[model samples]
Target: MKKKKYNTLWLSFLGVTAIPVLAIFIITMVVARNEFYEMRAIYGPNFIPATRESILMILIFVAGLILVANSLWMIWMKGMVIKPLRDIEAAAKRIAKGDLEFTIVTQRTDEIGELCRDFEEMRRQLKASQDARIYTEQQQKMFISNICHDLKTPITSIQGYVEGIMDGVATTPEMHSKYLKTIHNKANEMNLLINELTMYNKLDMDHVPYDFKEVNLKKYIDDCAEDLEDELATRGVNFGYRYNCADDVTVKVDPVQFSKVIHNLIGNSVKYMDKEDKRIDLRVKDYGNSVMLEIEDNGMGISEKDLPRICDRFYRGDSSRGKTKGSGIGLSIVKKIVGDHGGQISATSKVGLGTTMHVILKKSAGGKNG
Candidate 1:
């Protein structure tokens, strides 16, 4: 038979309780039985009967003592060892079954208590990791859903326009031009969405392909503003530019990606422009160690609730930004571009008024002032 772990302790205790009592009974029996006649010769004939009764009493006492010792050991083992192990075993089984919600507790200041604490810590970390995984999964699904929604609109329009053209619905030359133009625009929109998604994914993975060079802040802003002016003018929206920075101050940035940053910011502003006379102001200011570029607009502003999360990826849940159907990664792309250049982007806005986007970049020490 396989002896339990506590049996060793029980046997050790039996050495003191049962063994000694048994030894005493054996010794008493031998001495009483062997020394009977000698003691009777010394004392009286009645000693034999009395000695027999004393032996019976010793046997009873030893048996009772052994029984009591076994009983006490059983109770001690149940309370101190067996019950605690059973509790831990049950908890382990629950956790093995993927039930991380249960808790393990220990009041003793022993090794078992330390073991329980470690188990609890492991459970907590497991729960946290599971939650993070679930959140990532949800975000991925939302990304796919949002991308499909944005792509379907332009795709559907392109398909309809192509069908119209095939059916000869545009009978006149002007109608033909208009139908082809609409198809071209829809295709362009789809292309832009695809490009934004690709860029956002790259930025998210920190796989930036930048060509950093030191350029004069003043000159760069001026040239960029000129381009922005011409572009926005095409849409009948005015563009304003100002430079309040030192002429010699320079900053390192990837010109192409930085241009995208400007465009994205301006694009977001244009998306919400609601006034009859829409205008976007681009301003650059010197701040000793760094320079700040601000893009302000006279468009319908972002709500306070939306402003904080406007730059989050796939964040089209806002009331204002949702007014236009987009991939919702515009601000995310802008934020990533600015961050990659060791800069920060922020915004300030009021409902029904306008919004200003501020980007801060560290100034390069010395460069040719263009």
Candidate 2:
């Protein structure tokens, strides 16, 4: 190939041209010693003889040719190396300027070539990570804007209704009662926001001690579901379960927090169901000594792109905003509880199909799997 030939030529030029020129200079000096001495003896009386000048001119011309050839060879060698380096540098500059699409294609399989490959790979990874981070930040900002607008609308209405009542504009008992209930509802919404914020702050603290105990997980999940069944039924949501674990299947965790995890997941499933017979199913099974709980829902399922980040604090799928209800902290709290209990939680969903959340709780206390 042309590339192989070019590489071979550069290496040959470096070794043959540059190195031999150096050797010639040494050889010429030794060979011309007697000639120089003879010239010196013949010309010293005249000090600047014509014959000595001609001999010196010839030696100077030969030395100049050697110097020029060596210089050319070094320049050629540098071109092979420096060209790729400059290309890498330019690509890096483009990346710094916010272009993530650049790639380096160097032919030589040398250290510089390896360096270029690594540089390109690193740029690709950094761009992917940065793009994801920017998207997340934008989503967070939008959510905050939406939350602010949502909260402000109800609060403003409540304030106006209360003012009207105080100003004696509420003429009937029914009107007064409706206004009071509206105020109470808005106040409850504000309280819910405050509680969510408080819980989020607690979770953000890097290390919060969790008091974990060995829990009869099967019994616990059944109890939690039973407690929430009436609430779900009132909202036209049906709940079912398939418990395949032994009667004594257990896991080490804080019972209250573990209950909260199950509670939040089930609540969201019931709240967001889109089908006529809105349903959520919880299945528990034993994997060796560990326990696995899966919650499936026939709801407006999350998109694949958004599923990965659902557990992030304050993150809610944009599509779910109008259809679902919560402070966006429920899943985040569940993730923290599972993490503290030294377990793993993951979710899979299709846009129109449904969602399945898998929580794996280990039996041993000292080791955790992610």
Q: Which predicted model would earn the best lDDT?
A: 1
Model 2, 185-232: lDDT tens digits are: 988987777676677778778555677877776677788778777777
Model 1 pairs in collision: none
lDDT of 1 by residue, 1-370 (tens): 9965565556766676777777888888888877887887888877645668877887888778787977798778777876777777887888789778878777888777787788888888888898877776877788788778778988899889889989999999999999999999988988988898888989999888799999877788889888888999999998888898778888999988999999999998898888999989999887668888999999889888888977877776466434677766889899889998999999999988999999999887674333
User: Model 2 lDDT vs. the true structure?
Assistant: 0.78
Off by over 4 Å in 1: 1-128, 205-207, 320-322, 367-370
User: Which residue window of length 10 is worst by lDDT in model 2?
Assistant: 361-370
Candidate 1 lDDT for residue 65: 73
TM-score between model 1 and native: 0.70
* Model 2 CA deviation exceeding 4 Å by range: 1-72, 91-101, 322-327, 364-370
Query: Which TM-score value belongs to model 2?
Result: 0.78
lDDT of 1: 0.84
Q: What shift in Å separates residue 329 of candidate 2 from its native position after superposition?
A: 3.4
